[model samples]
Target: MAAAEEEVLGLLVGAVDQGTTSTRFLVFNSKTAELVSHHQIEITQEFPREGWVEQNPKEILLSVYECIEKTCEKLELLNIDRANVKAIGVANQRETTVVWDKITGEPLYNAVVWLDLRTQSTVENLNKRIPRNNNFVKSKTGLPVSTYFSAVKVRWLLDNVKKVQKAVEEDRALFGTIDSWLIWNLTGGTKGGVHCTDVTNASRTMLFNIHSLEWDKELCEFFEIPMKILPNVRSSSEIYGLMKVGALEGVPISGCLGDQSAALVGQMCFQDGQAKNTYGTGCFLLCNTGHKCVFSDHGLLTTVAYKLGRDKPVCYALEGSVAIAGALVSWLKNNLGIINRSHEIEELAKEVGTSYGCYFVPAFSGLYAPYWEPSARGIICGLTQFTNKCHIAYAALEAVCFQTREIWDAMNQDCGIPLNHLQVDGRMTDNKILMQLQADILCIPIIKSSMPEATALGAAMAAGAAEGVGIWNLELDSLSAFTMERFEPQINAEESEIRYSTWKKAVMKSMGWVTTESSESGDSSIFGSLHLGFFIVSSMVMLIGARYISGIP
Candidate 1:
């Protein structure tokens, strides 16, 4: 009977994926690599002002709690013993800032989402005070002085929100990303809740010194953020605390990572030069650089991939990002009313075999990696009378692919090795046409896993490993066999080059859209070398096309 019970109580782990748009709870069976039970709930985004995206911290917590309850109820309905769930791991949207009361754990203001650009003015002001070199902060934290990071968000809150300032003055303020907030509540809330963040999440905050693996006092002082309010940093995989409140109460809360890093682990990108691109609200391309933090000469972030346990060497990555990917599809559906649903964009795009001379750069919040042009704005060029919504939809999808190609070129140059194939996951991978387009443009096979929830699976893997679940062990290579589809390049190199070159022209038009007279902003030149990466590849083709078209040398 005991042995029978042992078989029934097989190794399992739970993952709470708190994303930009939703919260989810997923349970995984480590032995079979199966997602046993899961639940998800959409969270609302509030845009109080232009370029400001916020979410209620209370709502986020409630949504997460509800997801856990519903998921555990599903497990009960399936007659699985809840006790088998040994640990709960978390993967969250990184850089979203939340400042709460240290004693009450009540948020002073709504969470400043990673996408929020409210700190643009703050960033400009801070830049003057910091060392004049643009790479000064990057040398210490591997991130540029930009509004995209948590430190700037924290600074904005400290300056703007009176409640946040009061909390800080009263010594009651607590700062955290979504992962830290969720973990604190999951552990015990205000009552001895462990205040901590994993290394992956910490790396996103410009406050953290990636080399020293601690919150830099200098950065904290520069931002006027009190160190007392910051969460303690820890390894990506470890028993941070026991789940004090939940269906699986007392189960150890063992693992946590920023969503992009989690997807890297979930896709099993464990070696140098191996990479994964998550097509989420934004597209994130991460290439693992093993133990070394390979600073990008190209516009890419240096980040921690994951640290499995305390005292383990941290695995680092070179990250390039697109400010918009799936979000562009959402904008077309919600804002433009071009499609009824995001999935419909794919079919609509197929209605037109090509973009029909249209090229769209969805630089809604400006371009991110490689370009790093915050002043840039969205642009759609080469539109003709023949072009319609179908062409526009196709162009939108192509924008995602083209942006990816640009980043991949940077990763190739930074790592000094061409990636033969790309591993992909997230909401966007469901579109077969887009995946094919990605392969065609990049000229590499795009591999996607059998399970789409790579981010959640990564968190579960970390939890299971910490709990000594043999099946969740990282050493096993069998899990790599779970790849469901591989997209191979279908277009000829010449045609791919032509499409890419046209896209480049559209992006060039998008650059420097915002000038000093329009808004008190300065422009920075886009970084690239004529000898290497995407620029060279696209430039040669464009130059050749120009000469051929004009009948010149």
Candidate 2:
């Protein structure tokens, strides 16, 4: 409407970051390479049974809409016209599978979250038929046979979900990860929706051939997923489609990537061996491998980092992911009542002298990357009567470092390259003590950017690159504005190795605590004390509630 408003609006390039725990929208000032306005909404996590995690696809869609509207409202208040939103970039949680009706564009069942392990049987069956090392899918897709990937989850849905089965029989079913689901909805859903996914996301699906850069029909058949339900594979940066209707209408959706890959881009780790570790619901470390895909001999995964354009050379990455990181802190807060808030863990941890020989192995949903032990349960070893809440808090933080060290070791063994430094981002990186400990444990410098929203920045950069804006092409002078904190390794190499050895021993002891026979006999000690702590805290809260009900302060 006004000239000033139009100028402000023109700077809006919305980035929709659909992550494991939440959906966020960030409006970026492309000119200054800064976030002008943003909004985030947490999505619901449904645990139907042990080791089964799910999320409603429709709820995700609603959260996306809410984020977009809230972000646009903030932009408007800043004198930025919502009409100026030029493009939308999407970065989403990888390997979480969703199945929907192709004709109706309605999800047949809740999205089977990446953390879900209900498909372990399916993965085990496939693994039996194909040797772990010589598995053609592993050689092509750079992934191991695990329930963490999308293939098994998709197969389980088709076999178990009745509506999905009906849709597949009628040839009206469509399967996608969160990225594809969001893009389909954002672009206009069944009417003219594009059933496509970026190469980075596709590579993690296990059904896609990383070498061929397309869906593997044989693999699809092996998993019993129909090829027709799969999305068309595309590059990470390109005009997939335009926003048909929203707060920012007519804007092209130019960039898409799996959340971890996007974070790598956001951290500006463009060179080989450059890596970034994102600590969120889970911790994912991705090391850029340039054009070469080095198959992991050390339990790491080889995956597509990003593809710039159609026919352009695709970048590969060696990745190691830890399934629990910041979530452990939430557990300490909500379950154990060790702290009133998640943030307070860092403070309490700082107050403690040390972990005092305690080690917390957070394998609540089983260990990931390098270990791949699905049956492994969490344990806290070396606990003594002297152990206090601070000791547990410190041990929880140290657990993240220990898991990261394992990943880093695996990456080195897989790639035959040493890392001198690592770029870090995400909410947990704000803890200076954790960063220092990460540096000391990994024996490498940990560098963190001032802007913790690296995932959103990465998606925006991909969108800008696709549009020829060169948002990432900044000079060192201008790059100084991108603040970074570097934490150098403080411990000696021998000391680091000794501590690591102790941690490995602790992990080994934690793994076999719960077995099939023991579980059936009701002798499973998997979450015994930990779960008891939760119940104790709940009962305490109930007592407090009764007091409040009786008008007691």
lDDT of 2: 0.82
- In candidate 1, what are the lDDT values of residues 1-553, reduced to their tens digit? 2467547545788999999889999998776667899999999998765456899999999999999899888988987778878788899999999999978888999999997766766777787887665556788788888868899898888887899989899899999999999888888988889999999999999999999999898888888888998899999888899988868898988989999999999998999989999999999999999999899999999999999988678999999988889889988777666578889988988877688887888887768899877666777777544556777788888999999999999999988989999999998999999999999999989998898999999998888777343346876666666857999999999999999999998899877655422332222224311111233224423533433212233
Model 2, range 479-528, lDDT digits (tens) per residue?
Answer: 33787889999889998898889999989976744443332223335453
Residue 277 in candidate 2, Cα distance off native in Å = 0.8
Which candidate number maximizes lDDT?
1
**What TM-score should be assigned to candidate 1?**
0.91
Model 1: lowest-lDDT 10 consecutive positions? 528-537
Name the runs in model 2 displaced over 4 angstroms.
1-10, 131-133, 467-481, 513-553
Please give the lDDT score at residue 173 for candidate 2: 90
Which residue window of length 10 is worst by lDDT in model 2? 544-553
C-alpha lDDT (0 to 100) for residue 234 of candidate 2: 90
Q: Per-prediction RMSD in angstroms? A: 7.3, 4.5
